[model samples]
Target chain A: MRVNRPKDGDPISVALNAQERHVTFDASRGAEAPPELVQLLTPEGERVEHPAYDIDLTPEEVRGLYRDLVLVRRVDMEAVALQRQGELGIWASLLGQEAAQIGSGRALTDADMAFPTYREHGVAWCRGVDPVNLLGLFRGVNHGGWDPAEHNFHLYTIVIGSQTLHAVGYAMGIQRDGADAATIVYFGDGATSQGDVNESFIWASVFNAPVVFFCQNNQWAISEPLEKQSRIPLYRRASGFGFPGIRVDGNDVFACLAVTRQALKNAREGQGPTLIEAFTYRMGAHTTSDDPTRYRVAGELEAWKLKDPIERVKAYMFKNQLADQDFFDSIEAEAADLGRDVRKRCLEMPDPHPLEIFEHVYSEPHALLTEEREQYAAYLASFEGGER
Target chain B: MTTLTLAKAINEGLRTAMEDDSKVLIMGEDVGKLGGVFRVTDGLQKDFGESRVIDTPLAESGIIGTAIGLALRGYRPVCEIQFDGFVFPAADQIITQLAKMPLRSLGKIKLPVVVRIPCGGGIGAVEHHSESPEAYFTHTGGLRVVACSNPVDGYHMIQQAIRCDDPVIFFEPKRRYWDKAEVERGAAPLAFDRAQIVRPGTDVTVLTYGPMVKTCLEAAAAVEQDGRSLEVIDLRSLNPLDTEMVFESVRRTGRCVVAHEAPVFSGLGAELAARITEACFYSLEAPVLRAGGFSTPYPPSRLEDHYLPDLDRVLDAVDRTFAF
Candidate 1:
């Protein structure tokens, strides 16, 4: 039954209709796992080695990863609070997937590029983007705040599966330039259903483009479940496009780091694309606007809380005697300061002036725009009250 | 001056752009070995090699989406969308991503990507083959939309579009691909955004573009013996129109008629009529008239002759401007 797949439609029905095979939706997992997961650290903080993927991080590096996971969580918490306080229009919280972002983000070489979905605040932290720069976008002060070339990280792409094609194109450009560097693009399980993402897969395959498709399957896309996207595990979909795929324990930073490093290396070596499905869960509401209570049970949340991503890293450090009380306390203090700084900076972001709408619409001098701007400015000046 | 067909002119223009910039690439379906279905990229792969001239898969969204990425990576990728109707499949990339990315970047980056589309219907072809979907892109702010009516404009404007710092939607009339014209390669060419006075007259100012330019000029000659002088103007660029040239002609004639091969309702012709009325309101002899397709899907090709604007319809529209 597993060898001979039926047609797709209602993934659960298709998956169940296949004879003698069971399709189960684990509280945190998407599809039934036929492919073994690469896990370097268990939820209980025990350090384990995968047969195919392994990493030997120095104690200092593990502490840094721990610090990253904590600070990014703090940032996300502050953003959520800001939205509730009416300081931001909305915020998409990356509450549960820190290890997946940081581990994969850090694996990128300085020469490598990353195309990320909007929820990659943790990856932005890894890329050295100022925490304050991210707030500008949420504050509605700018669409994109930081220069991509400055960090080798492209601006957050909001359209699902759109950036994947750009990532492939950039990889194709790399091939043309004969560059050894590779590119990695981040998306959700929901984006796998988009034609652009599927087209990107074909493009990467045929051109032998150096691009890694990193899918952080947080189990939910707004309100829809993973069954709506695929019957097979998302990583397994890559083999149909003629590339290697693997599932990694997204909550385990060591496993994520090891798996991503190998995938990127394979791409740079001209082995073509690799799809790394980082299995994780979205522990928080999708955004400030969504209500998880509408669809899911509280017990699922309680179950996932036991396997918190940051807790596992902290436990691993403690068991190995890698970090002590002072180190953990300092990380906590640093996160607190970052949270306060981001809020202050976000409030201080000036609202763009009305005339600024005409700015940056084009690189060349547009006559029509110039005429419209002048006319609008004259009209505004005529408003008996100035600056209205 | 060398005479060449519109397709060959664009092919030569692409060759010129490639020769000048090593970073320029041509990517689309069948662009490499097939030189495109219209042969607009003929022999380009032979000269530039596979690295620069790429044959993409049969995915419009992929061609355009990847072109955006290639542009971000510092390569000027001139993408071909095969036909006009097929552009809708890639419209998401064009409108949301390609048109908005540079603006979203706040001028920190420039997308020099040029999207080449074969537009307008006169060719006897099936659906999704012949269409004039220019108004959609023209309405998009960050893009520059231009169409070439003849070979020289096709040659010079294509090369110029490649050199611009902005993303350009270049429409090459499919029906006029074999039309021949003299191209003065070394002479200073007018900018692609400027309009041209194809035929000068004192009575009526008729504005048209792309495939309809030839028909409008033919209408002008048809009206000459009837003692009604008509001036035909080809608006090469649609978005930031050359209103200076248009206003000059409209003011002198005191009459205006907008013509195209798109739908008459809410189409590019409507936008032109509004702009002309605003600028030449007092100089007008009548409300700007329009002559083009009806509000319907481009009908079966057997009826395309009735659907597309021809000489009589243009003359009638021009004659109506004298009514007021």
Candidate 2:
């Protein structure tokens, strides 16, 4: 007798088959056509409504966000110019991702902490880190110039996706302390594929730790596009880890602020991790050393220019009559001063002493470290005109 | 004075450290409700509460990565890797992040993290469970590596490692966990970096640490019966090497044999032999002989005894030095 067997898909097989389907942003349909994005404002500086996230910013607060965007851009431009002038070894310019960084960075309370990647200059501005202090890393003077604990922002982690785990752990610590603090971690779309990031998702979900994963999906991770990293939307990947995921218009400052504020609120209120995919584009090369022209088309950049993160905020400020020409002129003058000040400070940055390399290998005195220091000192003295 | 096994001593040490400081924590896989695979963290969770003794998911990298974060939050974290072989998954966090974080931050942050790994072979356990991966950590600059061969050392070394500001890789010999000795619980903590001569002699110097310390001690006893007095030095710290003690012992004996459970090629033995030869060239009775496992993956339980350095193997290397 032939037994009838039901042909049903197992959860694992179904998930794997679904993952095989390709997910990409269709340039032909344009950036505005992407579905399920919780956008509070459009590229044309028009206000929109979202059922989940909403914000009512005062005229003064709106102007402050605009100033932040413009000055962050100015600092980024100065860093790029400094790199070109050989004042810095390299600079990771956050040209188009300003709103994504500032919005999320500004949403945090004093109790909240942030773990950032190396390309978070805008977030550093929001965190009150001096722009010149950031130049020390790119200028090869120090790994990170300022104290991370003082600013509640950790030092920049260069190894991609590693900081996410640290953020979850810190969040766990907050839970242990019975505090209402939340933790936010910044990474790019490329970091989604990293094991540490995925592990962080699992740890946060299982522990129900308060954390917000803010990923700036800037369309390009170095040379690889979003298509190369994921077959599904990066936010959708969060659902598999048993958490809510949201996408926002990274170019719209209003949308970013509203979404991040809600996410941080949810985290502080004992909600587990939330993944916010800031759908933006990298408007410049990956870094000062990268040549994006070799990999991307100029037309793509032209298309994204209509959705400039800083320009939209500026348009909103002008359309709403929040500031007059005097306000604009003062901001421009302030930006110019900032640029000149950063350049001067970057050039005046003193080189660290050669022996400083052995200063902090260990917090305690190690016999091996002492021996190596002595050996290195002797070797340096052996050089012509070199002294120990 | 009370007698305690090495495993129990370590547990007591952890309990004491946690009692001393409210900021100290213990986190790892199976460390909580399950107590731990070897029961080294037994009853810790019941006493300290789940927040202090955490039972993490079965992810080695996550355990270490989070420990670094907790350390940054001004907490002293002691992480336990279930076995020696499982430490590889967390190598990036340990070697790249935990090890170099202080130096990378230029001393702006201090990571007081202790990664406790139960290493070496002797028990008929599965393959990955028994390995001596200390050399990989010792070679890394920003990490402090130490091992415990006996109960008293285990008791003090663990607390010392937790109190140290630097990241320390504390290797506990799993095979000797059950071995007991009388310990003075109120005695001052021993310096975690120095080597100690457990059994002194004048004819030959046998250098070993962790699990192999007992094997070398047995070999020393056997060689004494054969009218050969053998000096045994337990190298408590692998990174620092305790070169002064090693050099002094070798200078007195004029013959040396380094034994360990790890493979001979590029192992801790190789570094000790090279440094000893360079320092005591004129004091050499024979080229420094090494008794250790073959340069291969840790074999199956059936073949581990053959691969591991035992009493016979140590004596054979000692005899070879005499032949030279």
Candidate 3:
């Protein structure tokens, strides 16, 4: 299909554009899973080998990855259901991109740090942050629900491409501290358009900062497709910035794990930055508020489900007799319990007192806040019975 | 006691801050080798080495964005936006990220990052080089905004801002760079946010900051011939404006005038005028008058004299306040 962005044009041009602007979603190309895609596990339960990147996973480890992928997806589904039921303001589902998040997320050593764009729920799970903490931000109870220093997982940045520079800066700090640790930042295909991301690429390269740029090219950034974000492949774009760029099979959990571990190792070894383009698909809408039906083809979702990050792992486990029906049943029961617990805890979360607005704006006391807080308290008191 | 130019004092202050805290880093374009356009960070890289004194690629947003990350990693990064007008490129980082990062983290983090921008007109520099954009920052919450007018404050205030746990937008008047004054190096510095009454008087209270502090002081001396005493208050801190101190002066003087190189329309002067009028309403004998640049953008260097607030323009405001 010809690339046609919706535009109001002159009569002659409008006539030329009208037919192609009638965009029919075509996932028939199977959504362009790259030929160069580094895959360890194939779609139908086969363990494949890659020349450069490969990991020897024990059956238990493979099952463990499957558990992570399943649980993360389950948590994401719970959040989505909560959003539909008005329990959450919004939820950015990590549906098809679970392996991309969990694999890369699990690759980080305890000393390394992470900076995430708002959708890295799987990453947050790997970082030891309570899944409920993520809900608080979605529930509007707080801006961010956990301390970055506590988890080494910085708060989810809502602004597109803003966190990439922060990641590089954190890496530079680690470099200065003489620590053998790296920083990983999660952004999407669309964020590559932002000047800050490009600048971060320059910074990461020039400073020889120990950082990894993990871009999950999940096919769509809200409504725009991959073609809108870049002309060249997202990974290859890193070459111009003087860094090694690799395209990993984002759905294959093993590839994500192996590639990320190698990238982080290279970073800690003082080899500067690596851009890992995790080739995957957004199986669901961007957020609860988004409608993929409006801009995407339905068959695209179907095509990606075949290469689902969790299913392939499950298939591999079953083929290898990694577990019996009891194991699958147990995981399902655990997922159900987690969903119920999340819903209950989210509903129980209380609204902060109005006066809490005066808090945290400044770490130190300011005369303006002192007066504003006091005067606001008195004003509230002056009301009938303080409040209704 | 030693006499140093405002630029030199800031350079010394930065040097002192770097010595005091190993985590404090200085990053900007040309800050490492060139020592900055106005030499405010002169000789810093030579002493602190390249690690602490960083000459980043010429991108304002990148400079601040990385600084935020550094601050998150427990490093105090002082970023420099090469010029006043260039800060808008990083406004997303400064406004969306730097200003709100602390509140977003619910005080779990402290960003002791300082963004230094050389501001104001009168250096005969080109457009964008001479603009006072303090109002934009002061209007934003969660960011502490400050400007130092003279060498003493320049020396001590830079250190104070560095020590401040909040993200501070520190403005240095470009015109006042060469202005020299005595700085008692070892003396304990005044608090960062306190407003000082530079010259005491009982006539009209003229409140100003940064570049205009000197102008207001000059206006006070110029109006002294008319047997009028103008109380000049240099509001060192703009965001948590020392309005209480201004109220004290304005209540006594009964008239007020606010001056700055920034445009009079919706400038920091407007906020000062409104606050002073509101608090000292009954005590104020006249409405607060503002003397500042025109609403237009900072004009060419040749036309800056007319656009910027001069001693005569300030005196005119002081005279108008009396007439009221």
Candidate 4:
């Protein structure tokens, strides 16, 4: 049931004969290749049906997804505003990548593991991590704040593409432990050029690790365009590494959810890894300090305005009778309340004391650290309470 | 008891650790089939199988990053950096992430990973291969840096390092890999962060470690012939320096000289001198002296003999220490 090459044909039958098998490849033949997009809802207030996979969401569940997208965006905006107001040291805005993060984030079960880059505040939100915990990393206080065992979500990795390999390794561990959980690793388009990312792909394909490589193609890596990052389409690049590649409209929450759910099921059932290129745009600056006006033209931003992830979902909800005016008003209230709570938490975060720096260095104890802490404590005590 | 070389001692130490803890794993390039370039990890893969002993891709940062996650899952990983120069790509991970993860977690989580790097320059190697970069790790907090001089310390210290709850940088002096000594495999050995007085003398205290330990001891022997006793102490752990032993020797000898193969400015020698002056200021017979490489890049093989701190250079520092 292990097939390493995408071009191979005989293995498809072998995979079908397996006990947990399901129909994956569509049988419809066409002269031109299928546009990799799978959708149950369009970008402009329209509901469409997918011939391969259909969506049967209840009214409450549909409204819930919309609420998640709006609230996650609200929290994102608050963090960005905090950065501008000198509250945070730095911030990586997940402006247009919300649907990509939230959609894929909500697709996993509680048993699933997730690896995130520095820009995964949206994913962290979906994983039940408080906004304050996310702020601790950007503040000078801590590196990561959430426990992996609790939420099955790892801390944000800053080194470009390094988390991909870690995700692959964890997936291998999952396979060895005979767990039915699949790992999802999130990275940007910029990371796809790194050696670690490519190496992760090769290892994932070779070992058949139950993992998903979710690449958020957010157009600009600081200032470099997607054109500079890759020549061919990003999704097609996955085909070269012996995995099925899919290009989904990252701004479409329904499409993102459906595609990600399918990919995770395939991986958990021992179908190996899949590369998902969520083609989205970086609507905001790369981080708090970045000024996007230097590299990009205003026309490009105007063009992407039509593809706003939240607005399209809102349009669909209003066009259909899935959500009424009361639901929309209540969601707005919730978003405002969440934003206020985040602001209060960010401001009330007490600065860690100097002595707190030496704790948690080792699980047992170190003779050297114990000595240094003692000496450092005396040094700190020598100073007055008001001022050092 | 067995008389094993430094290389074989490390191999045995790794083997013992893997056998003792099922969660302990060994990872590096060429570590599985080749048993490491120096054979320090020999026969491990055959016994532990490919699942436990992993041969990683040619990426240093990748090895360390994944090891961090594995540690989060309650696994102890011992990573080999292959050579001195190869560790730089992982320096970012070591200095920023690995060093900060434990304390940053605020006593909730710990990263008990060991990074074994083959260091120092006397072995006729090309550019980037011969480097002495211990200062970088020693400067970082939340990391314990230690170097082994001979077979006995190499064996016991490695086991202690693995059992330790902290992330330890175990630097193996490449030149001393072939040197042999009888080592004991036991429950516990020397204290993890304490310094060992290799040679006890009185006139002057010579502080050194790793490859320079042998050179300092040789210089001590030569100085003994000249009607002078030189106290040679190996500061095994560099970060949390065994200040008690250092001050004790400096208090007796009254004169001190520090030797290492790294560049002179801002090297481990500078830190040792600063600490000694702070600890034993009144006991000084002369100002502290240092013998180290020049403030430049490691030179060609023909000039490396000059670049490395040999017995003559150490003795010269001793002469300056006494003359002061």
Candidate 5:
């Protein structure tokens, strides 16, 4: 009854060597994108039309989108500076994916809920979460600074693809309640390889849960490129799970907004889940802790720089004459004010009470927690007299 | 009072909780139609309707991940993992997400979710079915782990777990599911976090939980013929262990024997032994002895009788404690 179990092999030697040549980021050859991508605005600020998704924005609406893009970029820039200045521990900079986040975030109604990954500061801004509150996590003062229930936005989930299943579950609850409100969950291309994400797609498809799976394909998951994760396009994985999958020019704010809005509408109208793959790139390191120079070439960044999310929006504003010079100056001033306020507030943020660690472990009181708290207090008091 | 098996009592408790709160829902694999592999959720979907009692796809991570979502939406979800060995697939959700979300939110939100797992070996079941993985949940910080020994406790604890605001890991002893006891249907049971002295004795204290409670109790009864009285305590809650009760029993008996189905290496017994030694060091007449499964993977069904702790093993540990 001896069983001959398979032995482990080198993944680099086995999968990489055989498939490396065939795996290409170019979407021209029967890949997941290029054909199904719904782009309302090109990289050069040219306006276009889509058959399934479109939006007729007023001058004010167009200016509002532009302001959102600039402000979010400002917040990201300030946070990066704060990290470099040693005010914060680490930061996940959303340098290139501003349009993808702001577009989908702004599309949500007051009733729609969003479950975000840790790098969704743009979405947080659109949800009206104070940018300073976002610093609490990076500053090592708190895990989350705002109440999720207050803004219908959940705390940022750091674990890769874990939030997708929760989004689907929340959507199922909304279905059971017979509510028209929908749920949107954001993740990265790296998270598409996680088991929880695939499981969520299956559950959402079967239960017809009202959720939007928004994957910002930022090309690199740390050191591994998109070629390492999937051979086909990520959105194509959605159709296999019995749902409509769409790709959008993530750098184009117009396209992201329109596609996301349509997806939410489909969910609210009981059409089930939709996977919107935002074809974008991470313009910076994975985080302040990472060094992209170790793995990626400088040319890749240069290529993505020409298709900058904020630059395209700014170009569109200039070409369409949607906003005046006064409006642009006011926005710059507002962004400066936000950055200064965030910096001051972040520096002044008080550390939480030492005993706060034991507070939320359980909702009800327990004997063990009481004992542990008492022990910790005594341990802390032992050092009180030594400082003198 | 009604005589019911432990499984039936849990079913009744679930029904009562669902009836009491409209937000209470049951979701798991084969939970709606097949009534669960252990039949613990039998006939629940029929009475509660399809919306409340959901039959989920065969994905453990999906079950728990969605359960967290439901909790966020103001629903008390009681998720059933079919077997103890099957809970690993959902470990990320259970340990990382569900357990840490409330703490991460800084008390702004609470996940009122109960994950019910049928655990421990003894029914002659094969791999991925019989296992005592309670230590994993108990080791996690934000979860409250509890195990029931009999029908009465099962009935009351299942309801209390559902009502609990924090996420609870409810470990049901699979071998004892069919064990019957008289349950007061409408009456209150013991507190969810308290331990009970199932049998009073003065010679030695026998501490155990879940499926091992029955074995320890039987061992205590058998030792009575040899003119030795063994005190037995059922530690219902594992995380917030009733240390006071354990210390009190050990002080009177002056000896302790901890028994469980999990491996002895860093098992619940190790923690209990350390705490008991710290609290009742002067009162102890002998060192704490543990009777548990070997430090190996759960063996096949044919060899489970030897793998799982039994009355003979419990008595052997008690004798060793006295020999010291």
Candidate 6:
């Protein structure tokens, strides 16, 4: 069942023969019984069988997924770089959140609805939403450029914990419609403190809504570490709300994939919502405006680098003879191409026409919008006549 | 069909919405068994069961925050803030979260949640209970705010608020909750966010809403007896105001007076004055006068009569507008 665990005979072993890779394996075990942390794949390349959880992913599928992860990370990097270069006004980097997002996002069926915070570019990518369109929002060209129905992805909600409630409500709607699809909501550690998030927990638990609250607790919510927000573990907080929660290694794609699948299935099967605290690290600054160096040290960043999500998968591939050097090289090349395309597309995005603001405000037109749009157009026209 | 008080109308509205849609849930302190402190949600839990009409803890933020979740789950949630003053605790959810959700979502999601707050001063109650905070929600985009001044509106508006695709802050004038009227319970509902001109005239446009609608109507009648024609406009929809109606009236009368129980500083009066001035600049012959509560906290019940902008105060503002 193991898909991406490292091997004993890989270059990684030769490079670090004296020391073993530092992974907290025992931490994966928890008090709960049945739905144990669904991990078919281990961090090492050695394949191991899991009695409860297993996956029958093919070689081509494995290669294809590796490519997706690489491309997604590259897009994330390009967006971050664009933000730093002032091409984007702001960016919420998904630097360390790639595996958790990609794993959970790929698990969703086409009919499933996704509710995301500002940092779900990886999930959006999995949903086939053009990443360039997401940049239009931060670039001040438009608010949100993608339609939710088109991609089954809700717009990025910025007010911390607000989207969780909306997700629960949407789930309630799904239940009323007698639909089998589940709703997945994404949020950060900081959002857990919000009244809305807590309330979402209450509603989801009481109503038995078909929702999976995927909390990517990347340890820090804008310089405030996890300890500042909660005294107990974040996953344990779900128990108080009458639901099961699990802590998974967010950096491990296999762990994230397996756990998220179980959680989503649990919801769709009418068992109610499950809270997933993807325990990981924020490998980059919170956003373009953030200076992580001011709050954290380089050593902390280096420490997480050893547990790199993509590197472990690469190691597993190399050790298991899943792919050759040429295959890995081609994937890297594809990632580079994705990076270049993201930059080019982001630059070419047109500033939304002023009239677009008045559109989609309501499905039906109103007298006020018409009058205001007319007045605004007149005001803009007057500016054109006066200014150089 | 049924003659009911505004309170009873609201109670029936909750009952009907819950009956029509199981997803339509009601949550607030005492909303379950006690039917709310004002009994506006009375007998709902008994009919629909505790699952639909829930009695939540005494946390305004908790009530609203969870309501947002319920709405997200495809449940049309109607949340009650125990009192006008108690809404402040959950103001962050209302102002920052609920107000901007639809726009932030780029219209991908519609928040059909209704926040019902019993507002305005007249019952000689505490300070926070009487304050009119509609301007705050009105200023916030992605939120529709409306106030019901009478039993008819109280009934129809509650149903309309529930049916709206957008989130609505339904402000029930606490003073007028007990006001009885021969309400047509089965009448067709009005538009979601449009103002209703309760009393029309050609002399001047008297813009008012909430409990002050009665005061403005009384003032308009008194001024008519004094040989001065006056138009009283009941602004049911505070946000997305019925500026067209006000503008049309001002264009004819060349004068205006705005009234509310809230303080005048940056209040609904200010909004009306600015919009009227912009839309009817050349038509206006005099300054827009405002009759509202004084620049002070809602005083004791003994001083409430003076604190609330009554018929005399509104007429004085009308006189001042004519003087201008």
DockQ, per-model, please? 0.83, 0.74, 0.84, 0.32, 0.85, 0.36
Per-residue lDDT for B154-235 in model 6, tens only? 8888988898888889999998888898888667767756777788788888999999999899888887877898888888
Q: TM-scores for all candidates?
A: 0.96, 0.95, 0.96, 0.90, 0.97, 0.87
After aligning candidate 5 to the native by TM-score, how far in Å is the CA of B204 from where it should be? 0.7
Estimate, for each residue in A329-368, the C-alpha lDDT of model 1 and write its tens digit: 9999999999999889888889998898898889999889
Model 4, runs deviating above 4 Å? A1-35, A49-55, A139-141, A361-376, A383-387
Clashing pairs in 1: none
Model 5's CAPRI class is high
The lowest-lDDT stretch of 10 consecutive residues in candidate 4 chain A is A22-31
Global fold similarity of model 1 (TM-score) = 0.96
- Cα lDDT of model 5 by residue, A200-222, tens digit: 99999999999999999998899
Report lDDT (Cα) of residue B8, candidate 3.
Answer: 97
Tens digit of per-residue lDDT, candidate 5, span B1-324: 999999999999999999999999999999998899889999999998989999999999999999999999999999999999999999999999999998898888899999999999888887989999999888999999999989999999999999999999999999999999999987867899999999999999999999999988889889899999999999999989999899999999999999999999999999999999999999999999999999999999999999888999999999898797
Which 10-residue window of candidate 1 chain A scores lowest in summed lDDT?
A: A19-28
Which parts of model 2 are misplaced by more than 4 Å? A1-34, A382-385
Better of 5 and 6 by lDDT: 5
Q: How would you encode candidate 4's per-residue C-alpha lDDT over A59-170 as one tens digit per residue?
A: 8878888888898889889998888888889999898888899889999999889999999888888899887899887776777767766788887888788788778877
Report, to 2 decimal places, the DockQ of model 2: 0.74
lDDT of candidates 1 onward, in order: 0.91, 0.90, 0.91, 0.85, 0.92, 0.82
The residue ranges of model 3 lying beyond 4 angstroms of the native Cα positions read A1-35
Model 2 agreement with the true structure over B136-231: per-residue lDDT tens digits: 999998999999999999999999999999999999999999999998989986577899998999988999999999999999888787799999
Q: What is the lDDT of residue B119 in candidate 4?
A: 95
* Candidate 1 chain B lowest-lDDT run of ten: B315-324
Better of 2 and 5 by DockQ: 5
What C-alpha RMSD separates each model from the true structure?
A: 4.0, 4.1, 3.9, 9.0, 3.3, 9.7
